[model samples]
Target: MAPAPSADTLGTSAARARSAVLEEQIREDPGRFRMLTGDRPTGRLHLGHYFGTLHNRVRLQDLGVETYVIIADYQVLTDRDVADTLTEHVEELVLDYLAIGVDPERSTIFTHSAIPALNQLMLPFLSLVSVAELSRNPTVKDEIAHSRQSAVSGLMFTYPVHQAADILFCKGNLVPVGQDQLPHLEITRTIARRFNDRYGNGGTVFPEPDALLSRAPLLLGTDGTKMSKSRRNAVALAADADETARLLKAAKTDSERHITYDPAGRPEVSSLLLLAALCQNRTPEEVADDIGSAGAAALKKTVTEAVNEYLAPLRARRAEYAQDRAYLHRTLREGNERARAVAETTLAQVRTAMKNHY
Candidate 1:
């Protein structure tokens, strides 16, 4: 065996390895894989969510991969001081999923708070990870900085273990992730390997899942920072035509008159152009070239119109789904039941392997 790489090197290699592997396997036999991907139900998903993972999710499902999405309600409590809005956020997140083309029939969608069996796995999985390891995770560090809080909760620090439970509960072997999320997935892989080594009797009980990186462009916030709900810069996925226009119109732009795609030099202008490009399914350079010599006002107008037009059908469908609250409730209820059964089976195997089942 070769010597293990340094922490930084391992992080870089793992980020790219699974992505390359999945790209080859995807075209050959997508059905042979099981994928897990989802979001925290903190707010309505935005354009970043759409391009980031949602589109790849739909593609994987249509290609016959068994896919499971979690509206991670429990994760929201990590940094949040109140729980009053969680219920509302989870519901709106499901609507956003449906509006953006996540079919309940093809993909199983469940709330993290409802899955008892999955959460139970966290106990044994927690034992497999060390505090030193958890603290060293780059993603967690970045999250802490982003939270900008003096005190961080225990739940927030150990959320990656919970994430492992989320993936392994369904025996997921393919997780669609971005480069930024590779550390979390690496921890998941470590827990799986540790569990199998400790418990398996010549038969691996858990598979080390790999990352499937999407080529989707990351959309910056209107203020040129990372787009997020907490930042109050995100445009929700269900934003109506008028709402979309309003948000785009107010987005920050450069003082320069000419519109260009120089992200490093003119992030504000490039961010708007990037938004327009993604909405129109074109390159930022193409959009910039088309909008040649236009000022910030012209750039914002073009982006606002493009975004509103793109979200028009989604808003209409969301409105229809909103009217039938009962249907949404039923969809979630049925999905939770379906996901629980799978979690129970995996948990049963885990218990048997660990000699915890009596």
Candidate 2:
């Protein structure tokens, strides 16, 4: 497999895109606010979700931004060998989100399959987007190649367009994303620009959303690969203490018998240190320094203890919420309603501008 691109390259591209967005934002509105970010409901969110994306969303909610948590249920089929099990996966994801302090009242949590207006926006946006541009999107290409599917469905092919609908529906001006997802956000911005230029009643109908840069941690699995449910390399957020402990105990560490923070040569040790720091909001250097004179065994033990302790409260909250099916459904029901209210409004204006006249 080809090596992943270095952060230096990704950083340069991100800076350029962010500068362009910021220039437009200042000219548009100084205090403009609205955020859109979503997760693919392909499986239950793991520690990667918490350390990577969820925590940022929680912070955005606290900052008084209108946060929309979209479970891209429709995106699941884009790369599934068996798509029938998604219902349970989506439920577990919702429960996990709630357990992590994603308040539905402040954050609109809705599934992609339930939002009709957003899907409708996909139709016209699709018309405006070209096959070449979609094919050029790094994420769609990477996903298609990764899925190894013999024949990709049209829905899978146009997942980015659907994402544009997610942002445009809410007129979302900010998108919280990591480096890997910048390409997808770029596609969304391009679509927004194309639509506005073509049919944006006089002034641009859609404000191009900028990537809300997140200081996301690089999460790894037990095998030192990227954390993924399919690889069984992930520790689920809803996992009990015993489960988390077992996963951590089995986490891939080196035979050096000593811990070090050198990721260049000691990836496994670095991974464990990264995980511990993420769990406790400390720097890996800080954690390593605090583990002075404590060898590898002691370092791993301390990290494991810290992670398990941190997640204990989250697990309790998850258990309580998971038991109430009615509450889950009701929360989602209301969330979908709120999401649709905003989505339908933008979609209606889009229709009028495009002469769809629905």
Candidate 3:
């Protein structure tokens, strides 16, 4: 007989089952769901962001899910200082979203700073969770280690709670996240449940959001590490064909002459293969098979061509959007107003539930 599954395995299986159910429900009645997902205006979005989350966002939007994208500008202060370039990064992110088919008309896109009521939820949310729970959060620990700061900020410590506010503010029921992000979403679920239990008085306030696990695999950097703009190993979606080629040229690959996709034994080669496969809508193994015996040079060339070709239309659209700064700002303004209105309504409900609306 097979051995019993471990707790971790059971948890993963449960998440998968829940994700499948959510997907089916989304297909049947997308209007019944509200999705909240976004990025920090830290830097220009790269291929990782494009293939990982942006594509999925567009898919959900097209499926008619009411989407709320928060720019999380405040979150950036948790790790690094990007005050000087914050506005620039925000505008560029807007361009990427538009180019990638996230229609402002269909999906609301707003920044954290613009929604006061959203941030106000943080106070009550902070009271629900203990310091020990916050300290035990794996995501926060991982981020702190990655940031390598000598001293962590209070904001950074309570980052998960801030994320909770982001979700519950607009009553987001479906959050698109990768496996690694489950812990953060778990905290959000906990807060929602605790809030309702403590103050609901037979009325539930925030929906206990379920994770919509991302299907995309983690895309590594050209240097065979995590893809990040700070590392100078990422290929931004706004990069031109020449820039894309230049970046791909420096991608790490083994000395193996023959091309193959082996993520464990040959991560670098397989990463490039995966990049090309994602762009071409094919499997990495199929791509490696096509390039067998062609060598690393051939692999790099294929990846460069595939990435450039795939991003060509998006880059073109981004270029056009960048030309009209006024329109871009206007889009943000409208989204902020919409998000603020939603947040205000949710805040009112919270206050009434807690008898603090006096």
Task: Name the best candidate (by lDDT).
Answer: 3
Choose the strongest candidate by TM-score: 3
Better of 1 and 2 by lDDT: 1
Q: Check candidate 3 and list the clashing pairs.
A: none
- Error (Å) of candidate 1 at residue 306 is 0.8
**Ten residues in sequence with the least summed lDDT for candidate 1:** 9-18
Residue pairs with backbone overlap in model 1: none
Tens digits of per-residue lDDT, candidate 3, 68-187, equal 999999999998744789988999899999999999999999999999999999999999999999999888989898884678889999999999999999999999998778889999
lDDT ranking from best to worst? 3, 1, 2
The lDDT of each candidate is 0.87, 0.82, 0.92
lDDT of 2 by residue, 102-184 (tens): 99888899988788888888888888878999988888887787775788878778988888888889999888777777878
Cα error, candidate 1, residue 341 (Å)? 0.8
What TM-score, computed on C-alpha atoms, does each candidate reach? 0.94, 0.90, 0.97
| Backbone clashes counted, model 3 | 0
Off by over 4 Å in 3: 1-6, 356-358
Ranked by TM-score from best down, the candidates are 3, 1, 2
